[model samples]
Target: MSRLFLALFLFLLIREKYGYTNITLTVNYEKILAEVRKEFLSVSLDTHLIQLNWGGLNFENQRVQRYARNLAPAILRVGGTSADSLYFKPAFGKELASKNILPCYDPCNCDMDYKTVETFNMTARQWHQLANFAQRVGWTLLFDLNVLDRHNGSWTGKNAELLFDYASRKSVGPVYWQLGNEPNILPHFYNRSINPSTLGRDFLKLSTIVKKYKAFQQSLIVGPDVTHPKQDMNSSKPMKYLRAFLQAGGEALDAVSWHHYYFDGRQATADDFVNITHFDSFKEQAKLVCSETRRILGQKKSVWLTETSDGYGGGVRNLSQTFIANFLWLDKLGVSAQQGIELIVRQSFYHGCYGLLNPNLEPTPVYWLSVLHKRLVGTQVFNVSHNSGSKIRFYSHCGNRKSSLVVFGMNLNNFSVGVNFGKELAKVKFRVFIWTEDLVIKGFKDIQNKFVKDISFEMPPKSIAFVKFRKLVGVQACK
Candidate 1:
């Protein structure tokens, strides 16, 4: 695990300008995590990443770095629905009982747009572009197999397998596989009402055939990509079918995959993303699925988030730029890490309220926070103490031989704090940054305004700020 670093501001004029604000951070070099992480950890992403089709990576060919960096090597996940549309062309659309393919959209007839023509004009080439980009960036592939094949109620893994072979033919390392996006969401997505047992059976069958491919020995097979099995608000609970699937010889599967929306549903408000207390409500949901898997599969397997976004369906504009979004992302990451899961793939690097970065490749507040976390927080558990006001909270990462204090304080109100970090005085360095306004799409001033020069300032009405500190051997500290 790496500590995420947040860039406060890089002065264009590289000479350390004097009269700079002395924002002090306290670090205790004496304590570090006792349990060293044997393996380095990072994120995993869906096939389509930020700046790709949905977010338009080459839309303008802006050629900025990070939006693409968001998906490379560090994370690998397949974007399901988007891929389903292209790959799930119904060869026999009229015969299927389900209105759409297993994961197809409302306008099931789009198949003719591409199916009628061999070129697949309707396919989201953006995904191909994404895979190409990932490949170019030295990434591995885990292309999602088609669950919604065009011939009604029928599906095949041939095209998908071939697609993976095509996508990563020139690349190195083991390829990964997932039969469907989220099988639990299958019935609702395709307008079919199959129970979990049927979905599981289908998944098992799909996995069985896929494993026969030559790549099976070298690739990763992940399944049971469900979302919210606890309430079963709209689909069949996977546990029932999962047991049956395994009973029917689905053991060739390598990993358990799924999705999680902070609060189930889309287009939610920022307030919805910010409420951590609501998470307590989902704990039992996590427990149930984990326990079920343990009962059937065994303990200590792998659990991954194939998809997750704070607000729904990409989300609205400003919520992503709010204090709420900041707290929400942090809460999610902390929870996921603390849960001790194997990997967590963020919903997207772009296109949603929870996008770590924007379509233009600029870092969102959450992106900065995410970077900060990657640079500072490690596998070590640190004991922390802080006050929980409506917006601000502070905590310290307790390491066995070194400690780092992270104080993410939200000034939702009119006041600020001047704090003290114990006897580790004169051993801290600071990095501070701020997000003061919403992202404006069509404003000239929005693009031309001078970057702020002030160091200490009031947090704008809904903005979020980031300040980080690295403890050194001889830095001075506040009394």
Candidate 2:
């Protein structure tokens, strides 16, 4: 009896030492649920789109440009809170006019020169330079125009006319025009609210102005770029504002646009950065927007999440810039695509705390995640399922170019978990990319030769992996 007891203890210890909880993932490639658009993994460029100099050149540092080029087929939106206050000067030596500017907002105010209206101005020459830069980087510009002209109760088109004229003269690339930024929250800053009817009329007038120039006529007009509608007491205003805007001007819009942030920057922590539940709120917001747009327009129009990130106020210090943020970033992309969102423009490319690149234009973990997403995930989404519960989330997509299927999995557990691809893909070798806590990307590698019917691999705690099956069976979508 003593010998048997000792043997049992040794067996249990060995099992605990090298054991891994098995997880099986079943993917149905035949179900063609949705098509992820080519411009799915795009980003936004805020009002501080470029660093301008006195010589009127809009420039990006070489490092910034190099990092940006990796994430191509991207959409760059040049608008934010600063956009509403931007003063566009078409020519050099223009005298500073008092009426041309307004008080810059929170983030912009910190660096603004209060004495001159030129503090947040962008010259026409700078605009041309920006256009050239966009062309070189394979990005399409979604430029915003100032609409807070107090001289008229509605939007003013003077600066827009100048921009369009300059673009036409220089033969700049196509620019999607967004009239204003977050009109719903304008009341909080400007202490004035332009009602839906007034805004619709303004959009009509702006549309007319855009048509005057051949270059502008070819561009899309998307607007009422409102803030996310909240569920609490403060929600009524933005919700009502959107309903009214859609009712009045839904016909004029080529696409409906809005913004979202998972948490408030001031209160966010590292734990909050990896919390998967935070992503549910974003999906709910997308559903609300989709439902509202369909009801107002009598059909579903293309919806664009023009600006978004983990936290709103420039993001939390260590959380947004670290490897933890990749969980939120990649999950957001997967959820946004599943929710039928046409395009999701990440809040920033190279500005603010939530930016993919830091102030020095160095790539952050999120930037590396974006690069991998662009390379692995394609425009077609496949149905993926796992019984391992919420701690392990799985998303699959058709490969971008090869006859392959890409599966992205996030392991939020502290201990290592094993993922089995099942008998169908068991014999197939996978190209795996793992994003770890140290922000190091373990490039693609094949599993060992021993596993023929299943591949059992250990996933580190709080990490994400991208696995590509070189030739997945019955995935007609990739063909």
Candidate 3:
């Protein structure tokens, strides 16, 4: 079947089999004197802030900058597929000889060296420029190192130390240092010969070299930032590498970072745009990995969803570029909230599939949603529940400036529900946020970009919604 068919089939199967709710309701104040507590985690953008370790040309975008500034407490994951290009591959043929000296290392063909002082000078200048950029934005930096540098153990501790010192000296300290960008899976895609155990050893070596620099003391070392595991460890998977890291007593690193993408690579759904379970699944996986890593490390180090997106590659060509991104990108924030995770950054704010803005920097529908979550949600509170597995998840939040209710309405059974808050919820006012999908057939983008007019709605089957709340002007009895 086509990817689209698979998506539809998956949604149907989920609704028919694993869906949790059968009812949903809309409510007004004075009906439920429910006490909601403020429970928002810190917000940050996973800045792509793409870098060039090669000829030292950085493609910095002002739109991305504006996005980051608008979303403060941003985290910039500074590597991508381009991360592999330590230097541009040069051509020896007479046809096109203007090849830049490529950065050759193990498992990669980065064998060329600098032929001119200009290239070396350019690299140094770029690092400084990137450092300045991070400090200006107050970015929580995540430096994904070039692991291929040590491919055949070519990049010894001495060699790795040079790069680390260069970064520490030129750039502001990296808040988190991921060993490599999903190395476990790179072997299959890049034709790399490295295995999980080798990946682990290299990580250790990289960590050691990075620590030699004095500045690394202030920065945290996080590692194995493995790509999403295949269902059955089909390729150079991370599970074994991680298992080996623990067996080796991985005390050199401080945290474990991992990536996740929820949708089937082959498909997209009309309601797929509206699914929040993807966020839940990604967060859950990160949570599980974090739990397992902590168990292995025998310490309470944090786990970071350092890199994640909706589609596998550049993402499916669909409404993901539109409003569905709110649900798609909400994983960055909602997952953090769900797991009490310390930090989670989107894979790339502007890469092909995961980017929040277009090449022109037009905000995707998800960007606005991210803004709402960052600005509107609270920072600390207890668990918010509204009956187990009901289509609507109600959260009551109270804080210095506001008290609110957030209802996550999910519909799958083609059913409606009348929900009454318990006596504990009567005093709150309702100000809902809507998240229903544009009703479409399973395969079409029929209503992908559209949503309900308001939070008040009869949630359609196979749809999702988020309704928020606030107390009325004169309800001070709780004081």
lDDT of 2 by residue, 1-479 (tens): 99999999887677568653568778777776567568788887767443233112125656556666778888888888767777677785443323434322232122433224333567776676677778778888888888775465867687777777767887557788888788887765555677877887788787788878776777888887888744333733666788888888777888888888887776788888767588667777788887788778765577788889888767777767778888888888887776677788887786667878666557777887788888778877766787776778788888887778988978987766778776476656776666678645422122122113225466777878888777655677787
Q: Per-residue lDDT of 1-479 in model 1, one digit per residue for the tens?
A: 13322232444123235312212333343443122121212334433332122334343343434444433344556555534444533232222222232322211112222122221212334444545655565455566665665344445555665555454443345567676565555555555343455445566666666566564556667776766553445446665655665554346466676676665334455566546465554455556656666667776566665666564445445776444566556655544544444556666554444556564556665655555555444444333333334444333342112333343434443333333344443334444444444553232233224234332333444444444444443322210
> Highest lDDT: which candidate?
2
lDDT of 3 by residue, 164-239 (tens): 6566665475556655566666655455545556666666766676667777777777766776776645755566
Could you estimate the TM-score for every candidate? 0.63, 0.85, 0.68
Stretches of model 3 off by over 4 angstroms after superposition: 1-63, 87-122, 151-160, 170-175, 231-233, 264-266, 271-284, 378-381, 388-420, 435-479
Clash-forming residue pairs, model 2: none
Off by over 4 Å in 2: 1-20, 49-60, 93-120, 150-152, 229-236, 298-300, 439-456
Evaluated at residue 90, the lDDT of candidate 3 is 22
Full candidate order by TM-score, most accurate first: 2, 3, 1
Q: What is the C-alpha lDDT of each candidate?
A: 0.47, 0.72, 0.50
Q: Native-vs-model 3 lDDT?
A: 0.50
User: What lDDT does candidate 3 reach at residue 327?
Assistant: 50
Please list the Cα RMSD from the true structure of every candidate, rounded to 1 decimal place: 11.2, 4.9, 10.7
What is model 1's C-alpha RMSD? Answer: 11.2
